[model samples]
Target: MAWFSDAYHFEKSQLTVAHVTDCHLFKDQSGEYFGVNTAEYFARCLAAIAEHQVDCVVFGGDLTQDHSRDSYQLFAKLIADSPLLCPVFWLPGNHDELQEYHAIAGPHILSHKRITFQGGQLLLANSKGATPAGWVKQAHLEELSKGVDDTPSVVFCHHNPLPINGYLDKHLLENGPQLLNALVNTHHCIALFHGHVHHDYKYAFRGLNIYATPASSIQFTKQTTQWQQEDLGPAFRLITLNFDDTHSVQLTTDVVWLNG
Candidate 1:
């Protein structure tokens, strides 16, 4: 898990985005684990975001602990109840069901399309259905490759294209090379964001910035001898983009402690 300060610089723009992922929301109101309620922690995380004024929100994936319609309903309601005025963009997680999530979460969830017309271009690609690992379809890649201009483009998905030093590293996108091969070939994209490792990570690949946000509920210690979820600290990310004919991006780490 790694975090970088002032990761990138962009032109001045009022557009700000909050990135939250892997909520793993559950149906039980008790929000309990081993008979102890965990709902308080969930509430705390949501409440903490009220302090930030963002133009949009991006949920990277893993929206439910159990892939149930009820869980998606709760997640939808949670967003509706928030005081945020920003639009939301969602990508699927390994835990999410595409048909059910789209039915319940509405049209904000993205897949194989360019979603924004203002500030810059935001693209959401589907990479959740690959076996042995996640994948980006060739047709989708072809569309995505041509979608953005020299303007800064931020793409979101559920699978990480880069490998981290841990258990999940092996489970990364099965066709990452193909996807990245297209991305680099495009020469217009600024960064790629995703979730699934439940850890904060960023790596530069051939000039493209690839990043993954930590889980909002819990974080897993990476490259450890034994697999365990530790409080690397619950957190989110803030992305502000500045663009024109050419583009640049800035990412800030927002850490929200469950105790507060």
Candidate 2:
């Protein structure tokens, strides 16, 4: 972790968080998706994350491809075996069953949708819908309003809250405008993090940074009419929150690719 600090700004009281998403692990360890070995790739990503020694880690969803109890158990075991010495948080993706996740995830999982640090708050919402698409319900928005305060915050969910174009747009969050309205009302949010896109992306929505991380298992090609995999390998985002003299926090993000 100290070895990697030179690549990014480090300040006193700064919180470093590693974000990994869309592992898409299958029940069988040897299972391959689109000619890529997902489980092996995910393992390598975890090994890379361990080197960062982050304060905490967040799994941004799509934790499983088979949606089986075995898959979640395997995921738990992998994390347990890893060298990450911090709290772990996770949410459900479209492929996941919330109830099953709750049962397997146990206590480390966030019961409420928010976590507060000395400098800022981390808010999470469930966006998975009945179909493959997603929706941030009105109730979720209300919850977000209650959780957010004066502190700069980052919101995390499984689906992209804004459209990115091409075939992916068809499966975007259905009530994205409503979700954005809710976020706008918060007023203190600095960024929004999500998965499901399976590629690295950064954009701004109403002055807030919207970041989408590449999947831990595979990378997706952008601006395609149909699903396609990029030749690149797995990656994760390293986020740092540094406070200024006025106690205001500044957020910075860096993407770490396992194979380049």
Candidate 3:
């Protein structure tokens, strides 16, 4: 449902984002991930996102798995062919190639690392470190500090800041605490949303709220200590944002699971 306060506030102060992630698409159109068709699954995700009427869409990362240039192009093609009309923003994942993402020419896709709204600023930080584990560069940290002004804000990245399980935790963001202390916790960030863990999770770290979104392509079994995959339904997140009397933003987020 849309936010309602007064008509003007309702119209101007509300923002809804469709957060999708971890498609893991390969170069070939028929490529599948352990029997799951990543491209088809991504198409389903785009259709699901279209239903939300979001102001914008954020592809939280892991856009490709094979690390091929063609894979990234196919991702762009899928977005161009999808029903989503809102601006699309993305960041690179551990499996993605940075140069190809920078070279992509498309519609609706934005090169913006930061977007400002009447409610607050939305900062997209690149957490693609040297390894599978996440690390934000010194420059990104500087951007995060500058973008996160006195205005209330939210953060998006490709890596989870906290450990989730034995298998997933093995690749957890290497300097997660440093990231939290430097930008997320120190600034006026209400919540930090991420997707590398591939499970729906919520955590409170030093009074900051961090949320993880399930993958648009697949979900690893969350209860496992070892690596395991569930052929379960895929899901995305619908984040609704509204500003309060003090100009601080309040967000209501729900996970939308796609039908099998």
Q: Which numbered prediction scores highest in lDDT against the true structure?
A: 3
177-248: candidate 2 lDDT, tens digit per residue: 777767878888888899898888888878878899889887777888687787478899999987767888
| Tens-digit lDDT string for candidate 3 (1-260) | 01111111123577898889999999998999988899998988887788778888888999888988899888888888888888888877888776788788466777676666677757777898889999977666766766676867788989988787647788888888888887654568889999988879998788888999999887888867787887777789999888878777889999998867
Tens-place lDDT per residue, model 1, 129-203, is 646368877777776776654645778877888777876776788787778777777776778888888788888
| lDDT of every model, 2 decimals | 0.67, 0.77, 0.81
Off by over 4 Å in 1: 1-13, 32-40, 106-113, 117-119, 244-260
TM-score of each: 0.82, 0.90, 0.92
Task: Look at candidate 2 and tell me the lDDT of residue 7.
Answer: 19
Root-mean-square deviation of each candidate, in angstroms? Answer: 6.4, 6.2, 5.5
lDDT of 2 at 85: 60
Clashing pairs in 2: none
lDDT of 3 at 54: 88
Error of model 3, residue 30, in angstroms: 0.9
The candidate scoring highest on TM-score is 3
Number of clashing residue pairs in every model? 1, 0, 0
Model 3, position 64: C-alpha lDDT score: 88
- TM-score of structure candidate 3: 0.92
